[model samples]
Target: MRTLNVSISDIEYNKFGLKGEQLTFTDFVDMVSKELTRQKLNKCLQLADKYSLSKITMEEITNEVKAVRQDAKNRN
Candidate 1:
């Protein structure tokens, strides 16, 4: 979800069973994160296909939030 990386030099480069493949723990985590995102997106797409839902634009969402904040300010 966030672009954060860790470097632990004490661990051997090929500590993972993938010998000859120079992949670090951070690299492995990043690869898994990408795969998880892809799988989640695919699942959401499948669910969307099975159901009908209304979608709102980013601008519409932002405007609604702004309106709510303004109303709250007025109430106070």
Candidate 2:
């Protein structure tokens, strides 16, 4: 329900696929939010791969989660 005036370079405009496209404020916000989420997920995946966490077994991961939860519960 508000208006914001943002400026971007020609390259960025095209990269966002907004060149010659008419998008509503909500649509633009949604697009940008999705892109941000995707980037964060990709970064996490890269770090997990780098640390060899990507190959972690489900049982090990579950046990780790349970231990963390128990530790948090004890703190509370």
Candidate 3:
């Protein structure tokens, strides 16, 4: 196992009670990584909603919809 030293904000460390505690650094990193991934997924969903493309599928349906939209725009 390798050792890593990190510095976190006082509020965050106090909120999680990680200051001068017995928790392993690996555990802290894992927790932060999971939260980051969750946040990223939420952002992706928000963007999809903004573009009105949330109900898309990978088969012929989504492809046909995209092609039609492009064709309509190109004609104008």
Best by TM-score: 2
TM-score ranking from best candidate downward: 2, 3, 1
Model 3: how far is 71 from its true place, Å?
A: 18
Q: Per-residue lDDT of 1-76 in model 3, one digit per residue for the tens?
A: 7766677788878766565744687788887888799889999999989997687777767789889999999999
The reply for model 3, stretches above 4 Å from the true place, is 1-20, 60-76
Off by over 4 Å in 1: 1-20, 54-76
Residue ranges of candidate 2 with Cα displaced over 4 Å: 1-15, 18-20
Report the lDDT tens digits of candidate 2 across residue range 1-76.
6767778888888778785646688888898998899999999999999999999999999999999999999999
User: Which 10-residue window in model 3 sums to the lowest lDDT?
Assistant: 14-23
**Best first by lDDT, ranked:** 2, 3, 1
Model 1: per-residue Cα lDDT over 6-59, one tens digit each: 454435344433444355667788866876898899988878667642265679
Best by lDDT: 2
In model 2, the clashing pairs are none
RMSD of each: 9.8, 2.5, 7.0
- Summed over model 2, clashes come to 0
**What is the model-wide C-alpha lDDT for candidate 1?**
0.68
